[model samples]
Target chain A: MPYSETAREEQPRTPSLTIDALGKKCPIPIIWLAQRIGEVPLNAVVAVLADDPAAYTDVPAWCRLKSHPHVGTYELPEGGWSIHVRRNY
Target chain B: MLSAVEHSAVLHAAGVHERDGGAVSAVGVSRTGAVRVDAFAEAVAVPGTALACLQTANHEVGTLQPVAEVAAACREAGVPLLVDAAQTAGRLPLPEGWSVLTASAHKWGGPPGVGVLVVRKGTRFRSPLPEDEREGRRVPGFENVPAIVAAAAALRAGLAEEHEQERLSALVDRIRRTVPRVVPDVEVIGEDEDRAPHIVTFSCLYVAGEALLTELDKAGFAVSSGSSCTASTLRPSHVLEAMGVLTHGNIRVSLPRGASAADVDRFLEVLPGIVRRIRQEAGVSS
Candidate 1:
C-alpha cells in the first residue's frame, strides 16, 4: 500500500492516482489495479507500479480482458516499472 | 487424492471422476517443485483415504517427487498408490511400492492412441464410471495389437539408449546454469540434483510466453511454454505457480532421445535475443 499522489513530476504520463506496489509478486499488482480503478475519475490515467515478471505482460492482458485501455508502461529510474492504464468506462 | 504438481493428465483425470462426499486434498509441493513428502505423509495416514496418486517426475519442471518416502507412508496407511509414469516410463526406473501404474505411449515416441496400465496383484481398484458390460475378463475388447507392439518396441529402444541420460543431463545442466547468465531477469527453476535428466525450465521477466514461443518456433527451435496469455489456459502454469516462481514468460525444454548438443547450443545462442525482442514488443524492459 505505498500509494501516493505525487506532485506531477515523477512520470511522463501524469497519473491522477498511483498505486505503488513495488517488490510485490504476480497478481497482487493486478489485483490492486483492479480494486482501485473505479476510484479515479473517468478517462484519468491510473498508474500501478509493480516489479513482478507476470505484471509486465499481465497488466496489458488485464486491460484486454477487462476492456480497459492500457496507457503504456514506463521504466523507472531504479528497477521495476510504472504501468499506466486509462480509466475508460 | 492428488498433489499440487501432478501432471494435468492426472489432475484432469482425477478431476473428471464423479465424487459425492469424497473429499480430495492436493498435497502441496515445496519451493523446489518437489512434493512435500512430510505433508503428504500426514495426509495419507488419515483413515478412509481411498487412493493416492503421484507423478514420477514433473513434466514441466524436472523436479522428482519423493515417491519412495511417500510410498512407504502409503504402505503404512494401507492406501493404494497409483503412479503416473508417463514422463519416465522407459526413461527412468519405476519407483518401488507403486500399487498401480499408467503411462502414455506418445511420450516415448509410441503410437498416440495407446496407453499402458499396470495394476499390481491384490490392489483394489474399481472404475468410477459405470462398468462397461462387454465381457467378463481381466481386460476386455480387442486391443490395438500393432500399436501396442510398436509402443513396446519404442519403450525397449528408449531404454537401450539409457546412456543418453548422461549427455542430456549435461545439456540440461548447461541450460540450467547458462540461462540466467545469458538472459537478464531469468529464473531457472526445478531441482538440480534429484531431477529427471531430460527436462529444464526457466522463466524470463517482461516477456509474454506466447510471443517468445512463436519467435522461437520461427527460429526453428521446437519448445513448449507455460503462460497465462497463451492459447489454451488463461492462468499461468500451475506447476510454476505451485513452485511460487515467475509464472509468465516460462519455457520448458524437453530434450528428446538422441538430441544434439549443437542444437541446444544454438538454442542458447538464439534465446537471449528472442527474449529481448519479445520484451521489446511487449513494451517491457528488464
Candidate 2:
C-alpha cells in the first residue's frame, strides 16, 4: 500500500489543529492550548509550537493530568520545539 | 563574567578613580576565595602595597550589604572598592561608584574558566606576578580565544533576552506562592523586595538538604541543595547561614531565562510530597 493510504487505513480520520505558542514561557503554552483543545473536535490532533526548554517536561506532564494522549515531540531548527497531543473524550 | 579589561572599561566610562596603594574591596562575596581583599589588607607586610578591598553580603542570598555605603566610607577613609558581580551581575543593576569589578563568564551562561575583572583607567594596578605581553600588561597568559568570543556572544545574548527577566520574575513569584501552599511550614527565603528574580530558596522544616535533593533527583527533577556542592562535609549553605534561615534542609532553585511556568508548576506540585517524605524519613513531623 502507498504511504498516505497506509496511514489513513491504520489511523482514524481526525481534525488537525496547530497552536503557535513560540516564545511563550512555561504554563502559558500548555495552559492556552489545553483550554482551547476542548473547542477542537474530539480525537483531533493538536500540535503546539514552543521555544521554552521547560515545555518538554511540562507538556508531557500536562498530558498525563488532562487525560490527553501525548503522541510525540519534534525539534525544530532555528531554536524551537513542538509537542503533538491527541484529545480524547 | 566580565573580564578585567571589560570591567576596567566600564569603570573608565563611569569615571571612577582607582587610588594608588589602597585596599581592593568587593561587595556581596563569600569570605572564601577572597584573595583580592586578603592581598590588599596585608599589603604592608606582604609582597606589594595595593590598598583597600571590600565585598557585599552573600549574592546567592538577597542580603545587600552596604556596598555603595561601604565605598563611600572607604572613599572618606581613602581606600578603593572592587565589586564581585558573580550572582547579581546580569539580574540586578550594579552599585554605583565601584573602582573595579570582577565576574565569572560561566555563571552568566558563557563558557567556564573565564574570569572578568575591570579596573578603572589610571587605577594603579600592578600584576601580582611577572607577565609576558598579553591583555595590555594586565592579564597574563594566553587567553582562550574561542571562550572569549563565546563570552561576548553570551553577554550580548543575555542582554537581548532582557525581556524574559520579567517573565522569569513572575514565574519565581508563582513558585514563591505555590510552594508554600503545597508544603506547609516550608520557609521560602529571599522573598524580600530586593531579591534577584532568577533565584528562589527554601528549607523544609524537618528534612535534610541532601536527602531532599536525592529524592527530587530520583523523581526526575534537577535542583541544587546545600549539601550537593559539599557532599562530603554536608555543611549548610553560607548564604542561608548569613541570612540566619534554616540551613539543614535548604534548596536553591535558580531559573534560567528558558524555564517555563508549567515546568515550575510541575516541580512545585511534586515538591511538597518530596519534602514530606524526606521529613518522615528524618523523623521530623510535617
The whole-model lDDT of each prediction reads 0.79, 0.60
Q: Is the docking of candidate 2 incorrect, acceptable, medium or high quality?
A: incorrect
Work out candidate 2's RMSD over C-alphas. 21.8
Q: Give a tens-digit lDDT track for model 2, residues B1-286.
A: 1111112223333334334424332222222212222223333233332344433324444444445654565455455566766666665677875777777788678999887888987666766557778887777788899998998888778878867778887887888787878897666766444456777777665455667788888877777875334445533343443333445466778887699888898898888888877656644453
Model 1 chain B, poorest ten-residue lDDT window?
B129-138
Instruction: State which candidate has the highest TM-score.
Output: 1
Highest-lDDT candidate: 1
lDDT of candidate 1 over A1-89, digit per residue (tens) = 00111123334578999999898765467657777889999989998898775666556656644667777777788888888888888
Clashing pairs in 1: none
TM-score, per-candidate, Cα-based:
0.76, 0.60
Q: Which candidate is the best by DockQ?
A: 1
